[model samples]
Target: MQNKNHELHVICVNLLATLWDYNRVGKDAEDGDIEEIISMASKSDLADQEKQVQENIHSQITNFCTFMDQILLPESKSHETTSQKHSTAPRPSGLSLAIGRNAPPDTKFEIPETKPLTFAESCQRIKDLMGYTLELKPSQIPHEQAGQGLFVDGEADVGSVIALYPGVIYSPAYYRYIPGYPRVDSQNPYLITRYDGTVINGQPWGTGGETREPWAHSNVYRPNPSEPPSETGSDRVWKMLSKPLEGSRLGFNGEVLERRNPLALGHFANHPAMVMEPNVMVCPYDFPLNEKGMRAYIPNVVFGGVEEVKMKRFGSFWFKSRGESNDGQMTGPVMKSLALVATRLICNEEVYLNYRLSNSKRRPSWYTPVDEDEDRRRWS
Candidate 1:
C-alpha cells in the first residue's frame, strides 16, 4: 500500500510538471502526455484501492486541462507582447509573487501579457484569474434604501482579490472649479465626476472642460447603522481626489485623483448596510507602474524571483503588510491604481466596505482590519 501511494504521488507530480511546461511553451498539452498519465494511473494498484480516489484523479486532470485550454488557446485578437513570448521559460515554482517586498537579488520580475477585452470580458477574465466570481448589480436589500452593490457569485477565501476599483483618473484642480460643490463630508460616497462633465445627480457641468458622464455616481453609499459615529468627535470625510504632495511648498496639493470607470463593475459596489465586518478593503494597485504604458488596471498574478511552490495562491496578488522600510526609505515607484482586496472569507456573501473618507478612527464593528501576522501564517 505504501509503495502504491508513493507511486501515485510521483505520477501526479509529473503530470502537473508537464502541464506547467506546456503552459510555458504557449502550447496545449499533447494527447499522449495526458493519456500516458491516465494509463499509468489505471495500471497502478492505487486505482484499485479506492474508486473515489480514481474518480478524483480523473476530475483534477480534466479541470486542469480545461484551465490550460482557456489560457493557451489563441484569442481572435492577439494580445501577446514581445516580452511575454520571450520570457515563456518555466519558473522553478508556481507560487504567486509577493508585492511591496523588494525582488530577491538578481531576480527579474516580468509582467504577464493580456489581451484587450471589453468591460464584460474584463470582468470575466478577473473572475478566471482569481478563481472567484463577483457580480455588481441591484442589491436585494432594496434599491430605494441600500442601492446597487457587489455580491460574490462563488466562494472567495480570505485574501482573495475581489475586484479592481476601475475609473478615469483626474486631478484635484478639476473639482475646485465646480460651484457649490459639496464639501468633502463623512456622509457622502467618494465621487469622481465624469470626463464629459456629468454630475452624480445626472446634471451636466463643463467644470473639467470635458463632456463625459460621471462614473463615481454609479457606486452607491449604503450607510451602516451598526457603525458607531467617529470617536474623534468630528465627522471624518475622505476626499478621493486630493493627497498631500511630496516635498513641495504648495502645501499638499491633492494631485492624485480618479473617477470610477463607467465600464467597470466595481463602480456599482455599495457600502455596508449594518456594520458587520466588511470583507473587502481598498489599496493602490502595486505592480507595473501606470507610466509603463498600462492602458488599464486589471488584476492578474505576477511572478517574482523565488520559486518555492507550484501555482501561487490568489492572495499573492495584492499588497501585503510591511513595516516601515530601511530608514523610512520608499521602495519602488508609487502605484496609481486602487484595488479591492478581500480581508476575510467571503463565500456567496454580499460584499461590503467602509466608505468613510477618513482613515483615522477605528471602525471595528463595521470593518475588520487585516491581521498581518495571521495573513503571513496563512500564506507562508
Candidate 2:
C-alpha cells in the first residue's frame, strides 16, 4: 500500500509538471490549482483512467514532469527563497480560466550548468532531458575545415528533427545588454554584426534581468563577406548588393538564439563552407496565444464535460512559419524555443548548416524552403 501510494504521488507530480511544461498550467500555478490536480490524481485509479487517456499523452506527461523535477526544479529551488521575498504575493483565484500571476520571484528560467561532458555524453543527456532519441555524433572535419561537427550516425529522411540547440535563450534586449561586443566583433573590431543581420535584433529577452558576459561560445549567426554568392541566385545577389545597406525590412519577433555552452554538443555544428547545401535548419518553438487556450491543452482537465485538450504535449515538435499574415501582422503564437531540424536526407557523415544571413538583404542559399504542405508532412 505504501509503495502504491508513492507511485500515485509520483504520477500526480508528473501530471502537474506536464501541464505546466505544455503551458496548460501557467508557471505561476496557484496552490489551489496544484491541489486540484493532486486531488484528481489521488482519487482516480490509473487502471480505470487508462481506458480514457491516450497512451502517448500519458507517457509524454510523465516524462516531461520527471525531467522538470529532476533537472529544472533543483536549480530553481536554489534561488527560490530570494525570489519569493522579492516577488509579489499570490492573488486570489476567481474560478475563471485566466493565467495566474507572474511566476515566483525566484522562478528564473536559467539553464543550470552541468559538468563538462563529451560530445556523446552531451547528446545522451539532451535525449534524457527531452525524451527524444538522437543518433548523431560529434566528429572532426578534415583539412582546412579541421573543427568539430555533428554527423548523422544513421540514415535520416528529409524533414526529420535532427537535434535541439540547447542553451540559454536570450531576448534581443537582453542580448544587446550583455556586457561587451560579440566575440566576432571584438576580434575584428572593424566588423560588427547585429543579431539575425536585420536592422533590429528580434531575439526574445530572458526574464528576471539576469545577464551574463558575451563570449565566443554564444550562438550567433554572422555571414562571411569573403564567401562568394551562390550560383543559383546570382541575379538576386546582384540586386541585393546593388541596394543601399540601410533600409526597413521585415524582422522577426519572439526570435531567439541559444547561448552555446562548452558542455553542449549541438554548439559544435559548423557553418556551411562556401555555398554548399545544408542539412539542418534552425526553427522556433511555438507557444499558445492566450492563457485560456494554453489551459485548454492540459490533458484530463475537463470542465463540466467540455474537453479542452488540443495537443498531446507542448513543444516545437512542429514547424511553424514566422511569416506575416495578409494584414502584415505576425501569424501564429509567440515563439519560446528554437530547434535544429533536418532540411534534406542526412546520411552517416558530418552535417552542415548554412548559418549565413547576417543582413536581411538576401536569404541564405542553403535554406530549404518549406511550404505549408512540407511543414505538415515533417511534423506529421
Evaluate all candidate structures by whole-model CA lDDT and list the values in order: 0.36, 0.34
| TM-scores, one per candidate | 0.38, 0.34
Encode model 2's per-residue lDDT on 188-294: one tens digit a residue.
21121212211112121211111111111222322334445454464354334323311312111111112221112344455555445667654333322232211
Q: Residue 229 error for model 2, in Å?
A: 38
Cα RMSD of all models vs. native, in order, equals 17.6, 18.4
lDDT of 1 by residue, 96-179 (tens): 222213323233434233333333443355457546566666775433656566788766654344555443232222232222
* Model 2 regions lying over 4 Å from their true place: 1-140, 143-145, 182-265, 274-276, 287-335, 357-380
Per lDDT, the best of the predicted structures is 1
| Clash total of candidate 2 | 5
